[model samples]
Target: MRDRPVPQLPLALILSFLAVSGLLLLEDLFARPFTFLTGISFEAVRRGEMALLLGLAALLAARFVRRDLIHGLLERRAGKALPHLIGDVASLFVLVVGAAIIMTGVYGWDIGAVVAAGGLSLAIVGLALKDVILAVFNGAALNVENAFMVGDRVKIGEVDGTVVQSTWRSTTILTKARRLVTIPNIALGTASITNFDRPDKSEQRVIEICLDYDVTAESAERILLAGVIGAAGISLVDAPRVHAIRLDRDGVVYAIRYVIANHDLGLSSDHAVIKSILAHLRDAGIGVSYPKQEVVTAERRIRVADRTVDRRVLVQQCELFRGLPPDVQARIAEALIEQKVQAGAALIAAGAVRSSLFIVGEGLMKRLRARPDRPGFVEERYVATQAFGRRAFLSDLPHPAPIGAVTQSLVFELTRAAFAGILAAHPEIKVPLATNLARSPTLDITHATEVSALEARAERPVAFYLSLLDAIASSEANAR
Candidate 1:
């Protein structure tokens, strides 16, 4: 369109120009005036057919061959199909050049004045709409460079969003806030762009973990790495990593970095990774460390260590002991010994003779049973304050399955000798203890009196108590 010097040039101008020679040949009045003004020295100017032949040849070349070659060249150079405006410009330039050749070569006219006028007009347009022209060129260049495609998430300057459309003058972006933003191509040309689509769609993120300085770097890394790996939506191909940031007064700070699926899952994916880290921390028996100062206290009979749970608390957790007097409970608590086990370590072995009653104080203890038809073992987890080994401690029965530490854990264990002392001082404890040992451990005995009151509950209570006493006597023999 720019190649046309006249603001209103169209098919009518081309048609009127093609008919000029016919009218010149038909009437001497028109011919004489055209010849004098244009100064045409055409040897065949009097022939209308000659003018038509020249016009047809020019039209054929401009319409088919020249336009195709120009469009093909532009597309190949840009490595993509260019816009419709670019093709239209190319076609119009070809038409204008053909008309110029006809005017100068065929008509014997001087075109210097016409070229000068067209150049001056173009200069005026270049100065007036320079910003718009620059934007158009920038848009073309952006496509050629393959900087980013429509629908790609990108950050240009302060605007971060997905590109909705790219045009000759500007690009439209849809932000996360659901607002539409139109940015000029000139701005994109000057700004730095971060395209999420490049390299891959996955995004890299991080979480921080702090642990007591006493924990080895290797252990911290292993546990933290396991936590990140256990989370879903993580890209294992990238492989998660842990780095030590710095050593604090309270502990060592570690950064856990992992790659997830995409930018859209940002917060939800991070939350999953965090949950995994917490579970692994518990399993590893490592507490997240924080700043704390030790304070000296008065009237202390060796105050319980911050890291250790009170044994009395473990004793009170047991259903049988919870019903007993505090002094009687103290006797059992005094005899209890604190035992620690690391993750995956066996605390109770299958078929091993049970000599102690144990209560979990911290972390998890799990029982593992071999599958009847499968090769692997199934584990059932037991958490804090849950007691185990009542059947083993009250009778001579052996542990049916292996119990291991699922996480770093503490268990308060009351051995046969310690329990024997409590039973000796409190013989009435044996009735319920014998009942538990004689019946299925899974039975929920709300009252330890469930067995002691059997005399009233059962039709033949005498036979039941006698048999219960035998089991109690047998249990006492092991304590001895």
Candidate 2:
């Protein structure tokens, strides 16, 4: 005989019912009980059968209520408490507990002891993970506070990086060196942190300069203010100012300071402001100072020295003296005479009889246009040059343009006599006097004609006269 396949659930239910019915029938047949007791007329076997049917119905009801409805309710509650992993596990445990309760209560089995044991185990596990739970709490706090977001450059204690990821317990940061560093949330919360990108809407720009020691403090301040104001990318709200500070045995250090809008930082937009300041200083003939070092080959004590050059060679290289002939150049070179003026010396006064031209080779010279009675000089010009002076051989009436030096300058004197001699030799040298020249006479292109009458030439007399008038007008205009 071959074994039959196991019966299905429905078939098993039918078989169980039949077996119980048979047992009840045998119990009724073997032990006959009173059919009438307190006016009841049911057999003992029939009562037993009804009890068994009630038990089966209760089991089915308990399975639905405990395993399905109650389990689902507890699972939903646990799901809310655990967010990432713990919550899911808690939900599963709640579902398993509900199923156990249903099985024990409906089937008359004991499982309450097992439930107590499981609860004890869970308590022990929770105690061992106390630190992990605290970490989770810290992570939650970090997310809630939003102290720093992803891609934010933050410095915590000595660590600085861009926030890459944030979790409940830790954060990942990508450093400038392209390394990822993981840090605990609790540690980050306790450390000192700084964000470089803050204090929006305001920033400062600086231009460093080293001014010569001889420059007056007031003059340096005024020039710095002008330069900073004229520079680009400098905010108008923050006016420029200069700070003069002493250095170690060198000279005065000048800092041109101005503020810019913070949005312009690190964009190289504020560079133009610095560039403009430098250009302004250069245009005003203010030179940037460089370090000077002196070394003596053999000496008990080496003394610092200042070296000087002749101003004659300096003027030869100027653009103003270019294109002149060789002999004229020689005369101009030899005519340069050195003159010394004190610190407040007035070399030339406006409207005065302008005598020999003065060139500044060294030191400073000032030229003024205002009278002595004015509040200040109307025009003050400063000329500081290596070889700067007048060209030799010029008239006094039309004096060469006056220039002032601000330092000890080498000045060249060119008298009217020397200028006249050069002009007499170079007779072809003519100065431009006017824009318009005298008009030249028109050249008459016509000759006396024998057949002058238009009638003989078969031309209209009116047209011929008009053409002659137009030609005459054009010729006269050209001559003019």
Most TM-score-accurate candidate = 1
Off by over 4 Å in 2: 1-146, 151-153, 158-164, 172-183, 197-201, 205-208, 233-237, 267-270, 294-480
lDDT of 1 by residue, 1-480 (tens): 112122232465477655764665565656556667788743454543455546665665555433455445544575544444344445566677767767777677678877787898989999999999899888878877878876788999988998877777888889999999999988987999999988778888878877887666655665566566556565544767789999888788999887776767878878888887776566445567866696645342221112244566555555546566677777888887878787668998999997677866555566765544447555455544556775576565798788877555667788866666677668776566544433434322221222332222223233354464455556667656
lDDT of each: 0.65, 0.48
Per model, state how many residue pairs clash: 0, 20
* Superposed Cα deviation of residue 22, candidate 2 (Å): 37
Off by over 4 Å in 1: 1-116, 232-237, 282-480
Worst 10 residues of 1 by lDDT: 1-10
**Candidate 2 minimal-lDDT segment of 10 residues:** 433-442
TM-score of each: 0.47, 0.35
